[model samples]
Target chain A: MVIRPIVSGFPPNMHKVPVFADHLMLAQRFEHPFSQELGLTGFGLVTCLEGEAQFMINDQRLLLNTSSFAVINRGSRLMINVDETPARPVLLFFRSILADVVAAEIFHRQSGHDKELSYAELKDYRLTEYVHYTHASVKEVLEQAIQLSQSCASFQALKTDALLRSLLQSLGQENYQAIAVSARLPVVKQSTRVDLYKRLSHTKSWMDEHLTEDISLEDYADMALMNPAHFLRNFKTAFGITPHQYMMERRLELAKKLLQNTRQPVQEISEQIGFDVLSSFSYQFKKQEGLSPSQFRKQVTTD
Target chain B: MEESQWSKFKLRVNLNASVEEAYRCWATPAGLEEWFLRDASFKDAAGNAKDKNTLLQEGDTYQWLWYGYPDSVMEKGTVLKANGKDEFVFTFSLGCPVTISIYKEAGETIVQLVESDLPTDQGTMLQHFVGDSKGWIFYLANLKSILEGGLDLRNKKEELVDVITA
Candidate 1:
């Protein structure tokens, strides 16, 4: 399939806008399976308007149909595959500053106060990958954004900003609802609930910072000021995943980045992410990603 | 075909509130008065007066007044449909159909307003389409501000010009 670049440059007069850069591309026709390693410079939202697409982030695989979309953060390695014919997917990339604004709004709404958080700090708050099912309203808003980007309308920049804010807000609410549902409990005191959320956030941040180290459940539990068992349960309930699962996902994510961006050997990359043995790391990577480390690297690098 | 192509004004906003909370703001009289109108009341299909605090249901008739508007100036409409907490369809000034949809996205509530079935006459179209579009934009912004920041940016004074420079 021939990849058609629709809009590759930033809006010339829109420098003052929060979006630093934006690009839109369309695949003409999918004759053969295509894959590309996306070293995204900022936050990206990719929607499949017509056919199917596949995205691999860390060891997680997401399939995008007409109703589904993916949001990927910067500094992450993404492998995208298009196998279906007549696939027309649009990808929009925006600066991390825009993401930080959304993150700050969410934090303020949930925590009741705005804390100064840098782009890096906000990036750490993102899920490994966000895959959402779009309703008609969201689809219309996204379609409008694409239309505005393609148009030369004088207010296109402002219009696009408004649409993006709307999109981000929707995505934020979806994330919050997911957490609320997973951590289903009766209404508790606001102060206690906020404290619990803070502790959980700290635990996740701690995990991100120590992805390369040998960490224990006791350490995470202590960070949350709870017993090991209780911490494990609450963490799972709040995040919809156990502490071990979260750590493994983070390690794999780091390993994928090193493999794609650097010339590090697979064994060394494994060790860098806290894997002790080469064979075990390779086995686990292959089991989760459906390809060995070298093979995955070659697949991305050659394409 | 030409009439079917009448201009439609649509606006979307993501609020830092839940779907239920956002829906309430538009579905109930008290909720609407909080940020939208000055005085709002409704009656059910059976002509029974519905409490301002309760959610409006399908076939409910609404009488709405803006703060700066005179006592004689009031807008009347019917709640054509209210689909749970997700969608509410009602009639606005000049009988234009206004559809409000609320859905949870990411962790935020997204509220979308689409006003359609407008007059096709060129003069009427310009008056309602352009004028109401601008008004809706301000009202929507006020809705977001009031819900998220607890600040009402609406002009409650009668003498103040409501011109919003975008």
Candidate 2:
């Protein structure tokens, strides 16, 4: 495959650098009529500038509006087109090396694990997929990049590139999932609902932090500063489940993860998940997972 | 991250336009209305228009009444500093409190925004509020497109959703 860069002025060494590209670029919206094949070596980000664009990645058609951005997975086959206008989009390409180093440092992957480069995997890559910037902040980053790219000196552009890469990595999946949940809701101010939501949110965090404890409905109400009856009614309203049920469900989920990841026995797993009795733990695990503890472990290992 | 604490984020942009032009785009009722929204008005806490030096003065609070919303949002905070040509600092309130500083960097202006003293609920919510965060991410992209490319996405709200999801 002939190696070509859509933009000019990058160093020849940049072509061979093995990390995600840390630089800002600007491009008008334009179509690449010829399909491009990117191999597992690197990935790219295209932010539409003037017009609409379409990125066909691994058979999934992702449309890029003026502000819409899409991450092109490494080695993925893509057909990129600016259909609304002939102007091409500004593209930022990051080689896998940056992610590799980050994963090694933050996620602590074993030294020699091969990083998966498929589109499906990249979709779950929280760092690169979404950077939750305020509407104004996003403007600021793009505008800064544009200025730096157009600068007579390379210093600003280099710095801007570094900042951009860091920004991409900072956008974790946790943020993306939360934002996805918020955008789907109707815009209405329900004070009662909001208050209930506040309590539920508090309870969720409290539960996560106290997963090892013998938590009860009364304890949850105390955390939220509400009466037990009030807590139960509002918790149901906010989460569609009573506090006790929610806590149990979360505990079982944790138990399942522990069982799958750890070599601990069922009794230990049950104890770890706040269940005092091994039989009770076994029963609850079976009820939630549709399998006994040993059977679940066996299925996980074999699969 | 308690309700009493606040988080801050900043973005700087280099505009092809001049400082006054950019300032006008953000400051004036007419200018802010054009780029920010179709109907824009500035009011005080008691609901009155803010004008002139009062509009740009330190310690002065301006409430921006946006279209579709009955209540206006407030902007409070002293001007930490201002360069008539390209820089200024001000405090603003969204649903939460934030201090914003705007400055010009070379050809572009940088807006350093610090949203602090957020209630624990807001902070924790903001920390994990994925849906709100993503919306802001996309909205910021839209802001850049409008400012630089003269593209307005609000008009294409439905089509935007369609093509994006399609």
Candidate 3:
């Protein structure tokens, strides 16, 4: 696994600030399945810039695609995986110290009082569950943060603090409080759910890597350590699409890439992407994309 | 127009260090991080560094990250020349060529930097020339301070105002 760290900095001990930020790009293919266990010491804000990624936070499966954002509370156990597709993410880490500073500032502005607030008091308003949002405003702020991070201009730290404050304001405290309350009720069944999701997500990643190979429902179910019937139902429920449909969609996406990039004949391209018959490949291509494979190539080439 | 027709800005500072030491500060990643950038790494296309704790060579590329910035923000450039203990040239922001020369004068190291090949357009020339001139002046003073007084004057904190303004 080749992970390129674009920018990373951690505040020194005894510093006024308690924040660590990392921007990483995972562009290389992993020869072996790669996973990392992260025990976050601070609140984590992860923004996906491109491609797809899957992360398990406190045993809850979270999918991140382009412009997706996830906020993880401090002390959460997170398992992160880079999808076969290249994934780039910007991660901002801030400790409870910084959180307290922001909270105090907010409180002072509202009440005109400079009172000290504990982390426990902040907890009531903090996001406990790993929250995910696909909002445009979040993406815009993250983009600005990325730009400011690259600039050599002075006052970047001031700008970064403002951006962080803006992010917290945008994600209203009431919404997090509601999510935190609801997340507590599912603890009893969470272990099994975590196990099931982990296996299913692993199998799904396997399917993505082996898109050019023929795979069956039984193969994926076995990988998930479940019977085909149970696996089929759970997979559909977990991903909102049946395994067969998911595989077909992946194949069609690959077919589109091949059609656009390569000069191979339709029959060869179909076989290369695990389609045994040209007619079935062309039919699926037309069904998914309004144009046939050849038409897509011609249209894309002309454009 | 000939390359000589390009506008050039030069700045020189006298440091209480040897010529070799001043050159080392400019040529090595460790020296750069002390007073210039926050992080610096030099690597080849194969993602290998010849010596993890040494000076960069001609043709080597570098990625530089500044303090108090997001990890995703970095500067990348290739070393155009590295004359032993005397002169170094590299591409700065926006492909502008920068040359740093070190000389022993008056029992001190005089480090002179020249940034050339700026845009010839009247507006661009004024903006870049003026902006870079101010920036270099501040940074050179910072380099002198770190070398002489052993104090870093960078605004490493997020709340501090910028020293350089538009």
Taken in order, the candidates have interface RMSDs of 15.3, 17.6, 9.8
What is the full ranking by TM-score, best candidate first?
A: 3, 1, 2
Q: Cα miss at B153, model 1 (Å)? A: 28
Cα TM-score per model: 0.36, 0.30, 0.40
Which of the two, 1 or 3, has more TM-score? 3
Worst 10 residues of 2 chain B by lDDT: B157-166
Worst 10 residues of 3 chain B by lDDT: B157-166
Interface Cα RMSD for candidate 2?
17.6
The best candidate in terms of lDDT: 1
Over B42-109, each residue of candidate 3 has an lDDT whose tens digit, in order, gives: 88656687464587788888877666554444556788999877999998744688899999888888
Cα lDDT for residue A75, candidate 3: 64
- TM-score of chain A by itself in each prediction: 0.48, 0.41, 0.47
How are the candidates ranked when ordered by DockQ, highest leading? Answer: 3, 1, 2
DockQ for every model, please: 0.02, 0.01, 0.05
- For A232-290, candidate 2 gives per-residue lDDT tens digits of 87667545677778878888888878878999988888888888799998988889889
Candidate 3 residues A48-68, lDDT tens each? 676666777676687776645
lDDT per residue as tens, model 1, A1-303: 012342333343432322343233343335556676554334566667778888775454777767766666555456678877667656655545556666676666666433433334444424424455423555666665555444433223334454565566565555454345433433377445544665665567567767788989999899778899888877877777999989888788778888889999897898889989999889888888999999989988998
When summed lDDT is taken over every stretch of 10 residues in candidate 2 chain A, the lowest stretch is A126-135
What TM-score is obtained for chain B in each of the predicted models? Answer: 0.91, 0.55, 0.87
Score each candidate by Cα lDDT.
0.67, 0.49, 0.64
Candidate order by lDDT, decreasing, is 1, 3, 2
What does candidate 2 score on TM? Answer: 0.30
